[model samples]
Target: MLSKFYGEIFAILTSVCWAISALSFEIAGKKIGSLPMNLIRMSLALIFISIFSVFYNGNIIPQGANSEQLLYLVASGLVGFVIGDMLLFHSFVLIGARLGTLMMTMVAPISAIISWFALKEKMSLWQIFAMLVTIAGIFIVIYSRNKNHKKIEAKTKKASILFLGFLLAFGGAIGQAGGLVLSKKGVLNYDAFSASHIRIITGFLGYILIISFTRLWKKVFAGLKNTSALKTVSFGSFLGPFLGMSFSLIAVKNTSTGIAATLTSLAPVIIIIPAIFINKEKVSFLEILGAFIAVIGVALFFI
Candidate 1:
């Protein structure tokens, strides 16, 4: 019974883990900033994942990884973790988190189309319907929040900046889509955990190179002074890169890329219950309804 659903189960677990990490990362980002905190979390995540890879895979690194595997995984990290996240951050800066998140909903379909062409992966009619349902459900919840609050924290209220924000958000979707497709290719005949480590390595290095050229070393160093932020980042690293991303890879390995993307996209829905506990955000009936709708969409997979 569970075997057939294992991929989706892992994807849902990935969503839950991402919700937890996103909350922690949100706090850390407030304490420190996105770039510096990204470097910190990725560094710690590298250490954590390395240990896991060694213990679980019996190798310090992916000893069996060929050149092609390395290339694909590295590209996945650069596109997904670095470029996608950075562009989304810029969108947050320009348009606000609400709109940015709405834009990110593009990733699932974009990734689906990419996989269809690149990997010759195809979805069933039911699967397509389910994916749209899930995406639409999540969008309804996200859109409601934006409609009620409609807050876009920005220093400048420039029209050009808002337009740029839209572009960046779309770019983020494309980056993530490309990364998912590449990861599916990369992890072929490779250990998922090891592939995840390679991704972490590339993402960390990408940030390092960017910071180096931008001369943000001082800012990065300054971020290290805050002990509280470090603790938060460490926790986030454990949940996100180690657990969340690893499960994500496993999901993709076991399932089609489109299904994995849609299933993992349930983070917003999963975050609601936790929000109740954390008392950070208010939950409403619409959110609850949307979550139920999303679950119905997930259930459609089994049917």
Candidate 2:
């Protein structure tokens, strides 16, 4: 019973962690460029996760990871960390921070649906309706409330790269969905901590491969001098991959993947409070309505 309660708490915290990571990366990406920022931030996450893994598990390598499990972890890392985050970061560079974040909110449903079909998990009729309502709420929230659609007009004036960013975010979503399912499958026979370690190691290798091919090694090292970026990314890593992601795995261990994914999707709403205070973004009536509707949908999911 305690573990279940902890799982629910952690699932919610995962959304908050995601919001923090998104907010931090948006700031860092503004200065360092998305590509460099992606590599640097992910490396920080890898380092943080690795250290935690070592201290907690007494080893740096993946425990009980066979050849097949290693391959799955590597693939998961490549798709999620290397591909997903890179594209999402690029999106932040293309579109303004808010819109990019709005787009990312879609990932949860995408992941939930994919996990459902992949895992052959069953959902109740209410759960399906709730999922639909949640997705509708996302659309409502992202729908421009500007009298003249200022957000869209502004985006049109910016680089066309925002579309690419959306595509990349979508790719990242698929990768993440796949990673979750694969991790669930592989981790069944191992400790969750060790399983997470395997994932981070593979993710580290994926970033390394990208850095080599893109010739971004020099800039990455130079960017290391930017103490501010390092701090942000390091803090984000601690919240995100180390604590947030670990808890997500624990959530999946306790609940259906679809339910867990939906619950975690609440990050976007959690983000609104910060956006208002820090970024000084205005909240529209529609957005407020969407938030309430989404919250109701979340409640229905657990009914």
Candidate 3:
């Protein structure tokens, strides 16, 4: 039974892995700054993925990938890892992982829309309605109302910060959506692990370039010395870029990208319990309802 839904199973697992990793990255990002944290985590993830490649692919680097595959995968790394994650990690620091990841539920709809244009993929009316529901749920969670059920004015510094954080999270969604589509294109009929390895390599090199041009090595060195942050980043690196990303590729390879992305977007719901207990966040009833509604919207895609 489970074997029949291998892609769905892995997509669920990817959500779990990503939920935990997002919390870890949030903690570390707050301490080390998002830029440094991203560089270091990518570096650590590269090592972890390389080690896995040795056992799985029998090589430390991806093997047998053609030029076209490499190009798409590399572009995915740049868009997803460099741009998307940069925005996401910063949002984590600003808004907390719970809300930041909640915002990421947008990835499913965004992926579906991108696929429609990029891959000539068609969506049913139900799927279109699903996307709207997903967006509406996200708005319910993020938007605020006053006592009279009126929209709150964003006239304060705190509101501005929250607005920026949500905006960045949305940008991250775009990056991830674009990357997922590109990954599906590149990883077709390819080994998921090796394909992930290629993406990570590109991400690592992309970060190196950014750090070099921006002269952020000092911050990177400082982050390295922060043992607490280092430990948190290391754990996140394993779960995130290594396991979570590889599992995502496996899901996309085995199933439709829309279905796989929708399943993985359950991270918002899965992260709620952890946010309440581990992070000690006070989740409101509306937030919970919004999450379920969003997930229901995503689930509609599977039908």
Candidate 4:
């Protein structure tokens, strides 16, 4: 019985891990800025993953990964880790982790759509409806109305910042969705942990290039000296890239990409209570309702 739902279980675990890491990254990013924090996070995560790979795969590097596998997995890393997470960490700085993670709920539907085209994955009409329902839930959380039902004005600088943050989050969703499809293609029948190592290796290299070209070594070095932020980033890296991402690959390998993605997208819902308590963010009733509705929509994928 447990074997049958292995993919789903791992995906749910991934959500929990991501929720914690999202809050950690948010706190750290605010202090060190997104770019430097990302480089450091990837670096720490690479160390953690390398150690795990040594124990599990008997090597620090992924063994037996062919050129085709390397191609797709490398693309997944560049898109998901380098591009997607860069945008996401910045969004967390501007919008807070709760709202930023809420926006990431879009990853489910986006991944499904991308998988359809890229991996020949098919979705039924019911699944399509579920996707729409998920989008509606996200819309409810992000958009607000006045007492008279008027839309909020975008004139304020705060509003503008929020808009940009949400846009960045959306771009992250697209990158992550594309990455999921590519990971599915690359990791079929491959060792999930080893596959994760490959993705992280590429992502680490990508960030190295980005930091070098942008000449952000000073910022990166500064981030290292901030003990508080460094602790947070290190913890987030352990939860995120080392564990959460490896579990996600296992999920996609074990089940349909759509289902796996939907389950993993539960981070928003999982993070709500922690966001309220740990992050000390005020949670409105509407936000709670919207999260539940979104979860309901995600649940429909199982049926």
Candidate 5:
């Protein structure tokens, strides 16, 4: 009986896992920079996910997967990991994870729209209205009142960088949505963990191509020496690709894409407490209200 809601359960767990990883990656990205951090994180994640794969599936490589699954999973990896994560990590560095993840709330709507086109999934009027509420919450959080009642100076370089982060966050959302849609098509009857491994491999290869082309191979070695950063990366690797992403695939496989995406997109709200207390970032009451509104929107999807 409890097994029936596996999709929703895993999706919620994915949000928690992602919140932890986002904070960890934010720290590591700030320390080593996003480019180097990207290479190292994916590399480490591949190692971890591969280890899990070997024990879980009795093989280290994707075996018995047809060309279609392989192709789409590989594409998902390249777009989601290499491109989307680069943009996301940059946003984490530029605007901090709190704002970056908040901006990424669009992943729900993006996923819904893409699933509509690709999988012929349809949304009800109430769901569409809920999506709008989610967007409104994000807008409120992004444009929240400044700390101590201060106003943001629009004509400033800092403001410009924040705007760039916003754009990067949105791009990340689109990339992730595209990847999820592709993975849904690819993971038919495949083990969720196995699918995640293939996706990582594709991202790993994509990163290798980028670094080789750009002559950034040396930077990866340099990044490995950041012991402090590597520690965080290791933790993030386990929480993210190993558990977070695999379960996301499970959610996608077991439930409607829109429902899974909406549940997993709760990271922004989950990160708020850690950001405010642990990270000591200032958050306004308006932001809290906005988060509640977004949660309401997500909850509305069940109806």
Candidate 6:
């Protein structure tokens, strides 16, 4: 019973970690291209997850992972880590951090709906309504800043950038949704921690492939001396692939994909706490209201 409760807690923790990672990586990606940052962060994540899984589970590779499971995990790692993060980081470059994260809220519903069809997971009417409300909240947040003429004028010339950012974010949403379903399939027979290690291994390989095609390996080596940036990437890696992903797989194992994803979307709100206090960003009533609505939508998943 305690284990089950902790599982749920870990699921929520996954969201918090994701939020922190997104914010931190956004800052790092601004200095370095998303591809280079991805290579660094994923490398750190692979090493950290390997160490943690070995210490906790006494095994490195996922036990009983068959060919099909391996395929699914590899696919998941490629799409989620490679395509998904690549696009997401690009979106951060195209748009500002807040808007990029807001757009990414689509990941939960997209993944949830896809998981339902692909995995034949069930959802209650209330859950569907909750999803609708969550999307509504996201839209409100996006448009909420529109009412400010000054803000609009400031970002007006960059409309094209915002459009591309939206596209990248949408692509990432699809990748994350698909990745979750695939990971669910791949981890069906293994411990969550071990499954995480497998995913990280594939993710590491995917980044390596990116380096092969783009020759970004040299760039990554050059930027390694930026201690502050490297530290930020390391922090993001620790929160993201190491802890966030491990808990996410555990969440999907214990809960429905839709529920787990919706719950995870709470990251945006968690981000606000840091943004307001740490970043010293101003908060508006509408943003606060939108956050409240999103939280309510997340809560509806349990009902």
Q: How do all models score by TM-score?
A: 0.95, 0.85, 0.84, 0.86, 0.85, 0.87
Ranking by TM-score: 1, 6, 4, 5, 2, 3
Q: List the residue pairs that clash in candidate 1.
A: none
Highest-lDDT candidate = 1
Runs of candidate 5 exceeding 4 Å displacement: 1-4, 87-103, 129-135, 145-153, 158-169
Stretches off by above 4 angstroms in model 2 are 1-8, 90-105, 145-166, 278-280
lDDT of 4 by residue, 1-303 (tens): 778878878988998998899889879988987888888999999999999878886898789988999899999999988898878877876765556666676787889878888788887888778767766665555442121222232333387888898899889888888899899999997889889999989899999998999899999999999999999999999999889999999999987787788778767667777878877988777777878787787677566
Task: Give lDDT: candidate 1, residue 263.
Answer: 90
Better candidate by lDDT, 1 or 4: 1
Best-fitting candidate, scored by TM-score: 1
Model 1 residue runs over 4 Å out of place are 151-156
Question: What are the per-residue Cα lDDT tens digits for candidate 1 across 242-288?
Answer: 89999999999999889999999998888888788877777778888
lDDT scores in order: 0.88, 0.70, 0.82, 0.82, 0.80, 0.78
- Error (Å) of candidate 3 at residue 175 is 2.2
Q: What CA RMSD would you report for each candidate?
A: 1.8, 3.1, 3.8, 3.5, 3.2, 2.9
In candidate 2, the residue pairs with backbone N, CA or C atoms under 3 Å apart (3 or more residues apart, or in different chains) clash, namely none
Candidate ranking under lDDT, highest first, comes to 1, 4, 3, 5, 6, 2
What TM-score does candidate 5 reach? Answer: 0.85
Kindly report which residue pairs in candidate 3 clash with one another: none
Q: Which ten-residue region of model 2 has the weakest summed lDDT? A: 144-153
Deviation in Å, model 4, residue 122 alpha carbon:
1.0
The 10 consecutive residues of candidate 1 with the worst lDDT sum are: 148-157
Tens-place lDDT digits, model 2, residues 68-177: 76776667666766677666655655554455656655666666677678777777888778877876676577664433554565647644565676676666566666
**How far off is model 5, as Cα RMSD?**
3.2
